[model samples]
Target: MTYRRAAIPALIGGLLLAALLWWAGSSADALRLPGSVGTLGPDAVAELQRWVAPWAYDPPSFLDAGVQGHGYVLLGDDGRDRYNGIYTAGLQIRYGAVFAAFVLGALLLIRRLPPVRGRTTAAFLALWAWGAAAGTLAAAVSAPWFIAAAGHGSHRFLPQLASVTAAGRQLPVAVSLVAAGATVLVARIAAEGASTPPRTEVPARAARLAATAGTAVIALSVVVLSYQPVAAALQAYSPDGGLLAEPGDLLRQWLLLGAWDAPAAGAVVDWLLHRASDVLLLAVVWWALSRLPGLLTRVTLPAMAAGAVGATVLGLLASQLLRIAVVQTGPQQGLLYSSAAIGNGIPAALTCGLLAGVVATAVLRLSLRGAPEPAA
Candidate 1:
């Protein structure tokens, strides 16, 4: 089968699987997981209620269920819904779209590979297992983002999430993982027996050198662009805000814009806009990186993924240094927010990197198929 013929079908099937996964994940209350902070008590529960009361009508169900119940609480919480009628569908769509992006990434990688002759059932099972494994890691690493989003206004959101959700976080994660795996399986079936086109060749040495340099550039760009948010979040936590006064209190602040005092509608809009911008920027960076010599080679998908993740980690380290610089410049900068934002953004970098690599490689190979090689 031609690449185009297979890709379109594969993408369609993959998206259907992604939608199914999102639906299942969003419908259940106990699917989302919190970190391993042990448990909670009455005081902890009350604190959680106060922080989440602005947006969530039922703080207990919302926090206890983690991401799973966020939609229901905001939209389906009867008249107690406290979202001020500004954010219901948008919130739900944004959350589910994240999981769908995971599915799309898996499909991109699978489509790049040559099809194999195997029973459809067996292919589905194998692909599903692999996808589930990936989903589990994504869910685990992204716990901080979800936890913070739920209870960002509160200083104790993380612990409260862990306490309220108890052990229920595992179930939603498992179900979402299972759904994620299905997306992979469907993509594989759709692309069965497909063949790849000839690709443009570059000198191996040149390719390696170029990829290395490109990766470094990507890392630096992330650090520089991210400094503003990091600085803003830190400044928001200063004495000027009357939020915290001691360096010891910095870790308690959620790494988000100080939207606690903003109107619920405005806060939700700002947060979503920030999220969309980050994703768009990362995608653009990855797309450009994938086009660098040899980075998107068929056999190098794993390397591309690893490189993307490594760059994100390196950028996070640089951001920490930047934060330290700001602290050294002023005695009253306080401890500010933790490096949670960078840590939370890793999964996005990984998936987007893979998807970009696959797409760039495909486009280049297809475009150059019948062109004459440059005379060397």
Candidate 2:
């Protein structure tokens, strides 16, 4: 086999696998494993783990069931549905995508090789396929660990998300992820199977300028949307627009920013803005991780590892921010929802962050004309 073909994919697969293994450990409630401490009880801990636990995802039916109930139904007794809003992606959709990609990569690599009869080519493809699947599965399973460490959610699994705007609020973020993920998959696949197109790309200066402009646009839009309120009257909240005050004062009275001490409308605007901010910050975390190789040129591997740690840190910050922004900032109520939210968010954030870093390092190394070694 040509060295580039054999070595490049193996390296990328290794980096991807390492990231996945990190994610799986995170998913296992790395924060609250058997010895894990925190607000979550065994029951709550077990609740989120059911989704990402390793080898447990064998049956497609369980995933479908999880989606229908956790995905579509099941509001908690708290009158605010936490489960539906959290986890973000259903098990089958997220992990299934990973599994599919690995299987496809394996088949594509095998087919591209000079036609060899049966087992020899098959065995080689199987080894790489196994690597890809193992890594992707690890990341899927580890997703929860990063979420739990964030510490944002309630402790219960089936909490009610009875609020009206929440459904509207969550839709945009979910749509963004699905679209980005799909694009990444399709683009990478096309790049792999098709011949490398002629390298007539834009100059680095223009590309940097464009990236800067994109960041500025996203930032400005987020800020304006946060401050700007829609003129349409909001739907009457559950229990009849009880959001006339701060959330902590009364349970679920979360008038958001609109109903806050300010013009309830302004408060609502701020609340929405804050949600956008969390999403943007999560994006920042991802971008920062993607720059790991360039950022720490002398210590790329350690930098990748640090990217994982940083992701976990970012997830925790994001969780705290979400609690402050969305669900009422309060002292007295049960922390069930907060704990669960963190459990879900922290791991997922770390998962993405770590993946971004690994992928970044992989691409940088693979494309380098001649990478330098660290000094002795």
lDDT of 1 by residue, 228-288 (tens): 5554554445453332443222222222211122225647765444444434444434433
**Model 2 alpha-carbon miss at residue 350, Å:** 16
TM-score of candidate 2 against the unseen true structure: 0.30
Model 2 CA RMSD to the hidden true structure, in angstroms: 16.1
Model 1: pairs clashing at backbone N, Cα or C within 3 Å: 31-172, 33-169
Candidate 2 local Cα displacement, residue 294, angstroms: 7.8
Tell me the lDDT of candidate 1. Answer: 0.38
Candidate 2: tens digits of C-alpha lDDT, residues 133-249: 333343444344323322222332112222211211111122223322332333344345544322222233332332333233333322332233421122322232333322222
Q: What is the TM-score of each candidate against the true structure?
A: 0.38, 0.30
Runs of candidate 1 with Cα error greater than 4 angstroms are 1-87, 99-184, 196-200, 218-343, 347-376
